[model samples]
Target: MRFIRYVLRALNPKTAVTMDSRQVFRIRRCVVAGVIAVLVIAMVSCGVYGVKMHAQRAAQASQSATSTDKTTAKRQNSKKESSGKQSQKSQDNADTEDSVQAELKNQSASLTDDQRNEILAKAQQTARDNGHEPTQYTYCVAQKGDVGSLDDFANAVYRILNGERGWSRAGATFVQGADGNCDFNIVLSEARYMTTFSPDCSTEYSCRVDENVIINDDRWNGGTNDWLSAGGDMARYRVMVINHEVGHRLGHTDNETTCAGAGQLAPLMQEQSMHLDGCATNEYPLDGELWIK
Candidate 1:
């Protein structure tokens, strides 16, 4: 108002040419008011611009913070999902191991206490029967039909013959040799060819004909019903069949031995493949049947 009033007065004809002291004072006052007005406008404009700029910066910071929070949440969720999957996989493996152990336990429980104790005692005694003269025997493997890998079969045969639990503990050491050069022939024959060895050899079982130890591929692949019923698997059935047929070569007759007692281990000379006769299925030779003639 001061600046505008002074401008109006200076523009009037009465005050335009006048040089009075009062007019000079009025001009100075108007100049000061105009300078104050310019300063006030500049301050107000800068204040408004500063407020707008501050608001825009706050909005940007808010958006950035929200994005950062989302990213953190996603990382946390991903970690949780990975951890859950790993935990579930570990749990599944543990369950499988537990299931296998439970099955083994149930199979072990099928034996009577007396039979179990007797078997354990026999095993302990056999462990001490080690210092006898070792007899070395060479054997060859022959296969009929598809019996998987012959190399694997031969390896298993050698392992069974010379294994600690097999005839090896009886002081017999076995080596694989070429055909006709071996002391005995271990044959893995198909079920159809089992009877070719002799009429006594059947399609469902293994047999010994002089120097030939014929094994039924069907029984080798699938264990006997009696053995399986007695809580034995195919691997153990193979061990029993090999030892039993070879026991014939070792001077043991089939009828000479049977299950020692009810719930006792079937002797290696027993026809365990045909029947257990209420005895538990056993593969290795017992203490009394360990020596070769």
Candidate 2:
């Protein structure tokens, strides 16, 4: 009010003559309304800016959280894959260990000391009687845990090899020992374990694998039907078995030669134990039949 009165006093009477109380009141009210509208617009602009900034911060926070979640998931997946691979490798190693243990157990169950000694004694005696000079070939003799008398079997093998018309005629002499440094191995195996040494022959027949001659206990104990038909002699069958397996060690393969005549001697390389095929039983190799070079 004071500022208005001062303004009216400063003006001349003629200039202020039209001013009324109501008009002055109306002007004051208009001025107050304009100031309030300006203040309201400024407040509204500040509120809009605040809302925009808050929204931007919220969006940025959401994006960062999403990125963090993806990184964490990838790390977890990598860890799981690595763990899975390690687990599989461990399993494979465990399986290998088990297999080795089983094989060792099987080998450990083989021939006892007493049996080996008996076999050694017999082999020595037989070698004294039948072993010839020049020492052409040496063989290692081994027996399965359940097979009988390695010495007796070794002696039999020696006798056959040094017989009148045996491998000795071909200038090849065989000696028996347990040492690994032998030219060939003659293993007396039980029927149950034959396939372990001779996978090709399985259990049906004796076989030669590498330089190892595997002999089946079943055939040794009981002569085959062909041998029985000829003479029912266990001795002749033993001779045949030794010669056949040793023939394989001497670079001979399975020979399907049938007997030439009903009474002729079967070829030493023939599968005589299975079938004579109309041949007489002949344990010793015929003259010039050594075929060893």
Candidate 3:
């Protein structure tokens, strides 16, 4: 009330008028209420703005965290995929190796030392009994990749060449080993390795490529149908193969001759492996005409 009276006095100092005290008091109350209302509104606006800004920051932080998690997951997934591919490649390589080993095991054959020694002994004895001048040859039995025993093959070749009814009758002889000058090389090779000697010859047949008497491993293991049909004698076929190839080495050409008679022996120069026709199988040079003059 005193403050209102002072304000009123300052405003109307010159005019000394009679005013109601209640009206002055009502004016002062209205002014005070207006001021208080403005202050409350300012404080509420500041608090609302602050809360909005804090919410925005929190939302932004949450979005950033979500993006970071996604990036980490992508990286982890990529690593797992790369590791899986490498593991598959390693497994594939291991499988391929195992397959190769199995194939080799199936194709290979084994030969013993005792069997080789016996074959060598028999071949040497046969050479001595054939009554021919000693001719020298280098005999080597080879295989491509672990196919069979070299010793047994070498002995078989020696036995074939030194047989009583074979080249011995032609006065040609063979000395074992490469120490002496070799007239020719008798190579007993596996079927897979036959191409090394005679590139044009098939594994089903024997050939004389240059000075090499290339005998096929397949034919050595299995006899020809013609010989089997006649007597089922593998020995006879073995003898025939030896004579045929050796004949080529001794300047005998492919005769392609048939049997003169139905019961006669087939010519030694004939391709008996193909067919015997009506003739019996012959392993030797008949009529004493094959001798070296």
C-alpha TM-score for every candidate: 0.56, 0.52, 0.50
Arranged by lDDT, best first: 1, 2, 3
Best by TM-score: 1
Rank list by TM-score: 1, 2, 3
Candidate 2 Cα misplacement greater than 4 A, ranges: 1-135
| Segments in model 1 whose C-alpha atoms lie over 4 Å from true places | 1-129
Q: Residue 194 lDDT in model 3?
A: 73
Per-residue lDDT tens digits for candidate 3, residues 1-293, read: 98767666644635324556666566657767978999999999999999999999999999999899999899998999898999999998788657644543432324365654564455555545655554544544444545466655555555666565666656655535664346666666677777766568877777888777777767766868876776534555666787788778787766645567777888888777777777887877764435542
lDDT of 1 by residue, 170-281 (tens): 7777667894898999988889988888897788788889899988888877878888878776667777888888888988888577777888888888888778888888
Tell me the lDDT of candidate 2. 0.71
lDDT at position 105, candidate 2: 41
Error of model 1, residue 206, in angstroms: 0.7
Best by lDDT: 1
Winner of 2 and 3 under lDDT: 2
lDDT of 1 at 4: 72
Error of 3 at 238 (Å): 1.6
Superior by lDDT: candidate 1 or candidate 3: 1
Model 3 Cα RMSD, Å?
A: 18.5
Better of 1 and 2 by TM-score: 1
Q: Candidate 3 at 2: error in angstroms?
A: 99
